[model samples]
Target chain A: DVKVTQSSRYLVKRTGEKVFLECVQDMDHENMFWYRQDPGLGLRLIYFSYDVKMKEKGDIPEGYSVSREKKERFSLILESASTNQTSMYLCASSPNRGGGNTDTQYFGPGTRLTVL
Target chain B: GQQVMQIPQYQHVQEGEDFTTYCNSSTTLSNIQWYKQRPGGHPVFLIQLVKSGEVKKQKRLTFQFGEAKKNSSLHITATQTTDVGTYFCAYGQNFVFGPGTRLSVLP
Candidate 1:
């Protein structure tokens, strides 16, 4: 079974505070993604990484950044937390970028962040 | 930009009732995938449709991919409480997800 673990299940942060959400996958996957899910907005991509030290901006990358120092771990960083940034954050990893078929993604439990 | 859209944002149904959700993409998709997310849980991969005008079934659930590769639908026959959650269609070259349709099954 593929297991993806996140650093926190629920987090509360004050405005202007920096926050870090960590994700680690045991499958040694090459692609990782971070998304924020809102009520009606669904899941909006924040950032993604295809390899170590290689990152790509998703649809919504502003106010969020990602780091992948190792192959199995990816971290999403919020430079400054704000009220509008509070949402359910999800992390996912895939085996490779379209090796044969690559739409399947394994996801972490997700972190619910509240910016106060 | 590649985008996916789902209809009927929320659906409430009694046990044994049928439920269906539609997904439409703004651009042609290379392939489409379906995911289920239980309330308060992360999304889980369900199935993927690669060919145009292909239909796949998993027990009580049926999935269809449009011939144009621009639309898909998920139909549940005799939905149960276990089916309660959100259904999302993920498309695009990188799998951009739709808004999702929340399903509520009443016992």
Candidate 2:
């Protein structure tokens, strides 16, 4: 089974602090994504990496960034934590796919962050 | 920009009752995927529909893709306590997801 794991299940941080959320997938997937889920807002993508060192900005990319240095690991970084940034963060990985393939995504247990 | 929307922001039903959620996309989709996220849990992929006017079933759940490829629906034959969760519809070339629907089942 494909296993996606996140570093933290819950976290609390002070404002202005730099934070790092790590995600690793055991399966050799080519695509990795980071999304933040807020009440009523749904899962808004922050960043996605299709390959090592390649990244793309999603709908809500501000206040967040991502790094994909290896095939199995993706990291989400918060340059400066703020109260408004508190929410549930999810990481997902999917195998490479062409048009029409299902390429279903496997998600990791989310990390709920609270910025004070 | 593509938009995906799900109706019935929230639904409450008794056990053994039927439940359904509808999803509409602004632009025709190449494919549509459905996901379920239980309370306090991450979302999990349920099914994906590709062909226009396609319908698929998984035990008690039925998924249908509209003929125009711009809408989809998921219907549960009988609501169970375990079926409680938020159902999300994802579309677009980039798999942009709809806001999702929260379902509550009363036993």
Candidate 3:
């Protein structure tokens, strides 16, 4: 079974504080993604990394950044947490099959962050 | 960028009732994938359809792709409380996901 784990299940941060969310996948997938799920809005992609040290901005990347120093781990960073940034953050990974099509993505349990 | 739309943003059904959700796209889709996300959990892959007018079934769940390749539907028969969750349809290489249909099965 593919297992994806997140650093925190729930987190609380003060406004203007920096927050970090980490994710690790044991399946050795080459593509990783970060998304923030909100009510009504659904899951909005924040950022994605296709390889180590390579990242791409997704639809909503204004307030978030991502890092992938190793193939097995990905991290999401909030430079300065704000009330609007509080949401359920999810991390997912998929194996690259050499096609443009995205395969099934295995997701972590998710991290719920609250910016106070 | 590709996009998919889901209808009936929310649905509430009694146990043993049938439920269905639709996913539509303005343009022809190469393939469509369905996912189920239980409350407080992550989305999990359910099935994928590529051929036009393809129909696939998993026990009580039936998924159908349109002949035009622009739409798809997921139908659940005799939905149980375990069937409660958000169902999403995604397409394209970027995997643009639909807003999802939240299902609530009442006992």
| CAPRI tier of model 3 | medium
Please give the DockQ score of every candidate, comma-separated: 0.75, 0.71, 0.76
Q: Give the alpha carbon lDDT tens digit for every residue of B27-71 in model 1.
A: 888889999999999999999999999999999999999999999
Candidate 3 local lDDT, A9-38, one digit each (tens): 999999999999999999999999998899
Ranked candidates (DockQ, high to low): 3, 1, 2
Cα lDDT, all candidates: 0.93, 0.93, 0.93
Write the number of the candidate with greater DockQ, choosing between 2 and 3: 3
| Model 1 misplaced regions, further than 4 Å | A97-101
Clashing pairs in 2: none
Residue-by-residue lDDT tens digits, candidate 1, A68-115: 999999999999999999999999999885655665899999999999
Interface root-mean-square deviation, each candidate: 1.6, 1.6, 1.1
Docking quality of model 1: it rates as: medium
DockQ (0 to 1) for model 3: 0.76
User: Native contacts recovered, in order, as a fraction for each?
Assistant: 0.81, 0.68, 0.68
For residues B1-107, could you state the per-residue lDDT of candidate 2 as single tens digits? 77888998999999999999999988888899999999999999999999999999999999999999999999999989999999999875456789999999999
- In model 3, how large is the Cα lDDT of residue B75? 99
In candidate 2, position A99 carries an lDDT of 64
Candidate 1 backbone collisions, by pair:
none
